[model samples]
Target chain A: MPAIDLSTTPLRELNQSLHALAEGNNETEWEVLNPDGRHAVAVGIDAPVSVDIRGPVGYYCGGMNKQATVTVHGSAGPGVAENMMSGKVVIKGDVSQYAGATGRGGMLVVEGNAASRCGISMKGIDIVVKGSIGHMSAFMAQTGNLVVLGDAGDALGDSIYEARLFVRGNVQSLGADCVEKEMRDEHLELLEDLLQRSGITGVKPSEFRRYGSARKLYNFNIDNADAY
Target chain B: MCGIVGLFLKNEALEPQLGALTSAMLATMCERGPDSAGFAVYGQSLDGEAKITLQSSSPEIDFPALAKALENEIAGAVKLTQRATHAVLTCRRDELDTIRAAVRRLAPSVRVMGVGEAIEIYKEVGYPTAVSERFELKGMKGTHAIGHTRMATESAVTTLGAHPFSTGPDQCLVHNGSLSNHNNLRRSLAHDGIQLETQNDSEVAAAYLTWRMKQGLDLGQALEKSLDDLDGFFTFVVGTKNGFGVLRDPIACKPAVLAETDDYVAFGSEYRALVGLPGIDTAKVWEPEPATVYFWER
Candidate 1:
């Protein structure tokens, strides 16, 4: 394992060294020390490496990540793991606004609560939050799975599109075009796999209530104009 | 894109380090708002005594005889302390009105920064770190302090346009976003006998809160009322004589993080600003919710 202390070294140097990693390189495991709430740590990585950050990080911690497993031991600021293509990012503590925003392909696991706008505009991302989520989560989402273990705040999945939302706890209110939907065996099996992969046990898949887009705002029309 | 930081020390043991901690917190947000910066420190209040912070372009010329001029009219021995381009005049609480009138006549260019028994305001049109150094912020001791760095989207980058706007005695406000209805609010506030000093939207926000508080509203009630009356996206960090408060607008696009330990309560626009605080690793840190009032009082 190669260890880098960010307090004494420039963040650009660390990022540059990581970006320079080749496919066949032996330096596969990396440890980042003293992140100290710095912005854009471990961003834009394309290699299949494992990075363990030791402390809390500021905005956009694993942005645009691909083929990497980046784990933050502490909380994260806004836009964490934003716009990821392919990767696995895990936050051990709470996260601020818009965690995993606009991600195209990835799996994001948050062990703590998430603030507002979680997974906004997501595309094909699998997000699992062990704790509650704030308002307006999964807004305008397309092709994703959001699993929340605790109570969700107001306006969950507002103006959503083609996303499967599974909430085990209470949802304060649904958004304009979001409504409760039936959870078939396929959804139960998918949620089971997601829960098992995320190391979540003891919670049955049947406990969750599913929500999705009402599909009324898919096209512009005069009758359903208010929903649009 | 302004940055705001506030610290309220619950542990009196950390009271002496309030200025250093707040200055460091503001320094981390320099990139967010580089146009100008300002701060207000709420320190201990002396019985029957109050002070007013004044600023001028030429402190060397205006601050020299200000003490004697105020003492002659106010019938008390005025204490003056000058730092960079700003000065503080301390005297009997009831005689401040006379001193204000005398300072206007004696030093025509001096502008009052803030007036309170326990608050002193300092501001300059420069980077936050450099302005903090000019104000000797690291040397001051206080129970609580709030600071602001302005990006100047809605107003020009002048000393008055800088934040920590003090519209009420022992109360100051620092903002992180622009107000949309400040012009109309300014007109109505003027109709209600509240005069604002600048076209800056943040000053209007401060004056509005002060006006609401004057209408028999507490700080928390005034903030809750503001959610309905004020039109804007704002994350405000407010400082009162014995309290520190934070409020985010309904949409809450402007970010704000708050941390509370056994020793202190701290507010920062970003998590980076709070990383340097003591015991922050174990502190209960979280983002302030939208349209919520979080207040800590002594």
Candidate 2:
């Protein structure tokens, strides 16, 4: 493990130094000190490394990551791990829009609430938000699993695709293609696994309900044209 | 400092007369970014073809000679057909920057201004309405568009220091907050070979997005890529020929709302600004998530 001190060095130099370290060295974990909401703190890393951002970030904290695990001790701005291809990004605080959006692979775990379009158009990524989510949480989500441990706001999955959604609390309303689904054995098992993976404990597994695509709107039927 | 409007027709067939719609929306936002106004409307049938509006500081220079030089030297096939206090030209999409550079060289004393999309960027030291009228902005149209009214806190407020600054042809940005580390980020973007047009902090954001977009990323992906890299407490709106997108700062200081129906979608600095548009469902008008990106493709 190594250290990148952002306190005295300009954030650009500090980030560059860290990126260089990740690129040139073999250290698997790096500790950052005095990180104050800088953008692209640890972006475009291809190695298996863990970066602990000690403070908040402005936006796109660990974007386009592959085989890297970045953790933010504070809040994050919009687009954390956006378009990520592989690995894991864990934000301890709240995250802004399109968190893990269009992600082809990997997992994003947000311990706090997520803003609108949390997992928008996600492809093959699994997102577990421990708190509530805002409007259009998963708009046009083509694939992946969005597991929310709390409530969801308006348009949970409007114009959705094959993505599966599981919510533990009340849903304000379902979007265009999203609907309530039965919480069966497989769903409970999936919920338990996601909760455990997200490090969430103490809540009963049966307390949550499952919601996903109705599959009727997958092909855009003329009869369902009026639905939108 | 500036305003931008863009129209992308979904049908890509009718060449939707978006002039009136774009003009109307841009007019409403004159107060948001009064320095300049411009619009970029792409042809309906063309995959990425575009129509652009430009303004220059030096009106006396001959634009045709510069266009010729661009064609001969830079391989930019451009032609100047109209000349005014603010010059207008119909140019090849790939030749935009080259034509702009030629204008700068040909007329060193004058300012070479707004290019790409239907954006008619204007800049001055005054109100938005006067500039809107000066640009004759009420007549333009498109399918979907966005505009900005700016109050500059950092950077010069010149024509180059306007809102809805173009990162690429169709990707334009208008920001309401400041970037905390714009200088460093600007240097990084410049290091990546992306040009910086303005000293405004918002341009740093615009350049970041544009640079990412040029790397073969979609509009949404590019925006997401910029989030962690761009610092500050800001809310920004971007209108591209392909779609409309908005993002708020982490703390969510500035206010924004997303209102959508099957027919239309709108986001504004204030809900009242969108009051004039059709189909207002009070129930559907919702505040945007902080540090979140809301993108809709047309």
Candidate 3:
């Protein structure tokens, strides 16, 4: 176990150390102290290590992560876990805008509420928010599942694609080409798995309503060939 | 990009540390806006006393004579505290306009930064820390303060282009985004008899709020109306005599974080600016929503 205090050591040093880890490095568990809302903490890590950040972080924490788990004891600023691949990230407190945005693969969980564009243009990632999400969430998302246990703000899943949205509470309004769809048993199982992974309880998967693209914006037809 | 930081104190005990706290907060945001910085401090007001903050390109020549001329013309006791290139002239409250006119007459090169009973504005085309240090902001005492660091997106890098733009007495605003409709809005505001000192877009926003307030709207109402009238991305932190407010445009591309406790309310473009505050670890921190207004008054 290793501990890095960001207030004393430069943030780049901590991130560089994390990036320099060799295969099967003995120092697998790391603790970050006094993050103090700085930007780009623990970013671009490819090791299978667990980094526990003890305080709030600024922009783009845990960005482009791979094969690691990063947990923030406090809230995260914008772009937390952005472009993460094959890793787990958890924010125990509220997150700023674009949390887990454009993630290629990985599971990100926000125990607290998220600001707008929580998963804008997300690709092949799964995000579970224990609380509500803000407007324009999952906008034009090409892949992944976004589960919001609490209410969603205006324009939820606007112009979305392929991504599955499950909200137990109200949806202010759907985005263009985004409409409510039937929740099949497969969707229920998927939602259940995401909830269990996020350690969510006291909420049933059956309580959610699903939303997805209407297949009108991008889909083409022979009759409309001339329009292109 | 630009940075805006504001602190409104609820407890009197924390007032003495207001400037130091705000300066630290502003310094943390230097990366967001490195070209210039400005801040407005709302100090404790006395009976019928107002101050006008003035800045000049050549303070050595403009400030001393201007202070003496103002003292004689106003026929009242005048105190001029000089910083690097700025000065605060404390005088009789009713004579604010008279002194403003006198200073313009006495020193043609001097620019009145802001005028109010409690507000003292200082802005410069420099880094945030040096600007704060030159003004001795760490030693100043105030009840609340709003600060801005500018990156010079839509305007040139000059003292006037720096933020914490003042348009009305005891009112100031710091903005973090650009306005697309400023040229059009500036014309409309000018047509309505509102004068602006700078071609900076943020000043137009300040004038708009001043115009709204003149129409009998409070700070909160004025900010709400701005959501519809002002076009473009912005996260504005506004300061009045007794209160400070925060408003973000509906598109909300700009970021704003707010933290509140029993002692004070704080606003930062990002949470990083607030880490140095006392008891901040336990403060209730959250990002302000888009198209919303959050204000605090002592």
User: Highest DockQ, which number?
Assistant: 3
Residue B26's C-alpha lDDT in candidate 2?
Answer: 57
Q: What lDDT tens digits, residue by residue, belong to model 1 across residues B1-298?
A: 8888899999999888889998999999999999999999998899999989999976467575778867777667999999999999888988888888898888888889899999999999999999999998998898999988889898888999898899989889988888999999999999998999899988998998899989998888889999999999899988778878899998898999999998999999998899889999899998888999998888
Q: How much does candidate 2 score in TM-score?
A: 0.51
> How far off is each candidate at the interface, as Cα RMSD in Å?
0.7, 11.8, 0.6
Model 3, residue A124: C-alpha shift (Å): 0.4
RMSD of every prediction: 1.5, 18.9, 1.4
**lDDT (tens digit, per residue) of candidate 3 on B1-298:** 8888999999899988998999999999999998999999999899999999988997467677778888889787888898889899999888888998888787888898999999999999999999999999998898999999999988889999898999999999999888999999999999999988888999999999999999999999999999989999899999999888999888787999998999999999999899999999889888888998987765
**Per-residue C-alpha lDDT of model 2 across residues B1-298, encoded as one tens digit per residue:** 2333333344433234454555555555565566554433332323333344455565556656655765676664554544344555656666666666665676666554445545444444446555555655555445565556656679766666766677676567777778899999989888998878677898889888888878888778877877789888777777666577788776565645455655566665543344444554332555576667778886
Clashes of 1: 0
- When summed lDDT is taken over every stretch of 10 residues in candidate 1 chain A, the lowest stretch is A219-228
Q: Is candidate 1 or candidate 3 better by DockQ?
A: 3
lDDT of 1 by residue, A11-62 (tens): 9988898899999889989999999999999999999999999999999999
Clashing pairs in 3: A158-A175
